[model samples]
Target: MSRALLARNGRRALPLIYGGRRGTDTLSGVHLAARRFIVDMSYSAHFMDFKGSSIASSMKKLVVTKLSPNFREAVSTQTVAVPTPGDADLLVRNRFVGINASDINYSAGRYDPSVKPPFDAGFEGIGEVVGLGLSASSRYTVGDTVAYFGSGAFAEYTVVPAKEAVPVPAVKPEFLTLLVSGATAYIALKRLGDLAKGETVLVTAAAGGTGQFAVQFAKQAGCHVIGTCSTNEKAGFLKSIGCDRPINYTAEDLAKTLKKEYPQGIDVVYESVGGSVLELAVNSLANKGRLIVIGFISGYQSASGIPPFKGGTLPVKLLQKSASIRGFFLPHFLGDYREAMSSMIQMFAKGQLVCEVDFGDLAEEGKFVGLDAVFRAVDYMYAGRNLGKVVVEVAPPSVSNSKL
Candidate 1:
């Protein structure tokens, strides 16, 4: 029998014939090609159990139809042939996929201009290894639960490089937070915050996903943790998570409160909000302070991509106080990924860390479930209606159950 291998990433189609020779080509960091089996017919044996059939042949996935601020309008679902993993890859049946504030930006072509429309969406996912290529079998076995960070995660299944997949203990959604949100906080604070005991660390949007981790990490570093949020409910949530001070910016002006309460100024600022809030963080820096900019969420849904900087300090104030602002883009800090993720996983398992996830299962306006719920989840996050990491359930327990 013959199987047709669909082309992806501009590569030509490569057909796989039973007991035939193999070929290979690489695209988007994954190898797509035919695999040669020692038993000649082991191909069906490797993939037949994916859905209790001889590989259903097709899968449903999300794709970016165009760039738009409206995430609901930017993406569309399509039924496509399941991708065959090359020797270095594992075909994963995605269970849950994590949502990020930057998803809208990616859809708007802000992350990579070279990428055109009709590209895959999503960055982090947790799944079970359903199929493995020859080389991947050495490191990963079918049914191994793994969490991966890459594009094309907004799908029922994702083909991830075995080297890039983190061997997880289970198919739980908490691990998804560690892959991206936890890593962002752990690495940024450890490397750039230069945190010290008794110092004051302020995390804006502290009730949100990555911000919550930043708050906890700062507290763990023996620093006095201060968190900023929009409402009293978020303030209470921050306090419950070890935040020494939870500033409700809406109840009182942020600048005035900082001047009154923290007259010495904030020692370190984990600034995510842009526009006026960013300016306030910059102006409130203490002597030798450092502000780590993980993202400008305020501008993510805007047309300009990034809000115009209006810091009064500019270069003169920073020079005088010896304060600095450092930007953190996770991809640039790949070296620290393993260490950061390992520590986060251990801490979470031991109950030393909390992984808050808003599965979008309970929404006042509407409930979210299944792949179709991604749009509502994105809208919920942008509306600041979510208190923690947002995620969408791609497949239920029946389909995502791992042998482990």
Candidate 2:
């Protein structure tokens, strides 16, 4: 006989398979040992019951408290009912969430013009499909590991629309790279930047999650990738990932280095660092060079707003060089680029592209686990502490071995 046993994690009650064993009253000497083993496994490990057919009633989630200029103070945790998927949606049990500056900006109520407070937080995440909506297509099934860079990722369980979820292999792909970071690097380079072979490419803040991916994509395009970072440690990582040159911006004058090293001017400038850096990249662009503006993290938390645009004189410089600057907002261009995500994953599978992700326990360095660690991850990024993509393990790296 079988019985449903509730777990401490509160996910759901598990249906335990065994002989007709009731309670302590019905236990014999040999049966008592077997019952005790089952009980220990049930109560101790959280996942045994998470695999239960019945869904969790409530889940842990981070919600925006109020609209404040400061992101750190604007959010708090709450226990909420797990959302059921709509007809075309899938119910995903999240394992990890990749932190980005956008999360901080969102909490500060900066980016989205119409966004208000008390909303679910986050964007990029990796998880498994636990439940499927009835009218949804069979393209995805329960237990399929998937990656999603969408809204409402700061919860243990988030509903992903069928069209947005990117299915991966049984062993999880480095979803941190395949989702947001990889898409930004691949799409922006091909569609907006128009990268070419043998051309010189400059990536600002190159040690960052998206920036590192940008460096690799630029290199893979046969461009000479030059990365700029604040520390030598970050610069070293850039070189290891196929960067041609890594300029320590804090140690060297970026403008002077660019002018002296490449008198012919740069061919493609992937300028994410703004202020003087943006202007400098524009000034150093070769004839017909294209500059793709990703994001300026230099002043994200600054009360004074965007950094100074001291690019000497923009009109005269760009007119002489015949170069153009275009801005890329990933949210504005998300769904249209699933093809790029697929390409990145295929390249990774072939060992052509190197995808490095920090999974807390998976790495030897700093670790950030669970929803509560998100704020610290943001601060780590702000402090330029991460060498690769910073991913928070909401659950352990893999859950397949566990009954859940």
Candidate 3:
């Protein structure tokens, strides 16, 4: 019988053990052995049960106590009652949470001004379903792994709508990238950029979370990809990811290099870093070229939150070459999420794409663990220290494997 079943029927099962020949009253030996077996079985049952469920009454989650340009000062961890799932929600035990450049922007109330203080502080998380609501049970079961996009992902447990959560093969960090980073790149380039074969593409912040996917996708689309980064290490990463030209902008003057190397101008630009870098991309756009603006990380930390560009000549520049600029925000493209996420996940599983995750574990300063480590992870991202998708480990899986 299974250990769970044996544990449940321990009392009835104990009497069945034979002591002496048949009806011997000296049952001490059999009783002792049965008791030990029952104890072991019951413990195993409890361990397995807890893995699919939780008995804790409360959990810790990061909350934005106030609006601040500095991410470290804006959020604080607070213990609150574990939220019960709504009829259409699933309670997930978060394993790992993805970090993004906009984390600081959200903290500064840049996304929504009406959202007051003390709000949830995260965007996406990958975890196992620990509890299913009445209607959610129809689609999800306990122990099923899912990656979800919702508020409050920085918590140990988060309640996500059944419709928003995408089931994955396993609860791995690679799947987390598909939720936001991968989706943004795939959807933006496919829908807006209109990438074509033989096109010359430029990706700013190319080694960043979303930029990595952008570089690979541009290459897969048969385009010549030029990736820009601040350091040689990131430039090397861009080369490994199929970038035709890995420009370490700090080492070489970006404008001079682009002007000399590609006087014909770039066909498409996936520009993220703002300020002077954005100007460079616009100046280098070819006739009928398209520049997709995904983010402006260079100004995300500034007091003004994304500073305005000087010499407001964007219209003149675009008109000069018949070029256009488009902005991409993930939420506006939610309708295409399932298809994009599925395709990325399939490509990832087939080894056609690389999903890099920086857990902040190998950092020489310290490792990221628990909610407390989120601050460090955010800093690591903005500092341009991370290689790929930066994620914070919230709660690790159970390690005990003792068998009775």
Identify the candidate with maximal TM-score: 1
lDDT of 2 at 383: 73
Give Cα distance to truth, residue 265, candidate 2, Å: 1.1
The candidate 2 region of ten consecutive residues with least summed lDDT is 25-34
For candidate 3, give the lDDT: 0.80
- Badly placed stretches (over 4 Å) of model 3 are 1-54, 400-404
Scored by lDDT, model 1 comes in at 0.80
lDDT by residue (tens digit), candidate 2, 29-139: 111111211222232222212344345689898888886545678788889988767667877888888888667668877877598878988887777776655344234
Worst 10 residues of 3 by lDDT: 24-33
The candidate scoring highest on lDDT is 1
The C-alpha TM-scores of every prediction are 0.87, 0.82, 0.86
Summarize candidate 1's per-residue lDDT along 1-404 as a digit string, tens digits. Answer: 22222222333323333333333211111222343332322333233234432356788888999898678889998899998887778888888999999888899988889999999989999977777766676555566678999999998888998889987778888989888889999999999999999999999999998998999999999999989998898898888889998989789887888899999998999989888888888888999999999999888877877887876557987898899999999999999988787778778878999888887656874655677778888888988878889988887765333353
Model 2 residue 3 distance off true place after TM-score fit, in angstroms? 10
Assess candidate 3 and give its TM-score to the true structure: 0.86
Candidate 3 clash figure, as a count: 0
Q: Arrange candidates by TM-score, descending.
A: 1, 3, 2
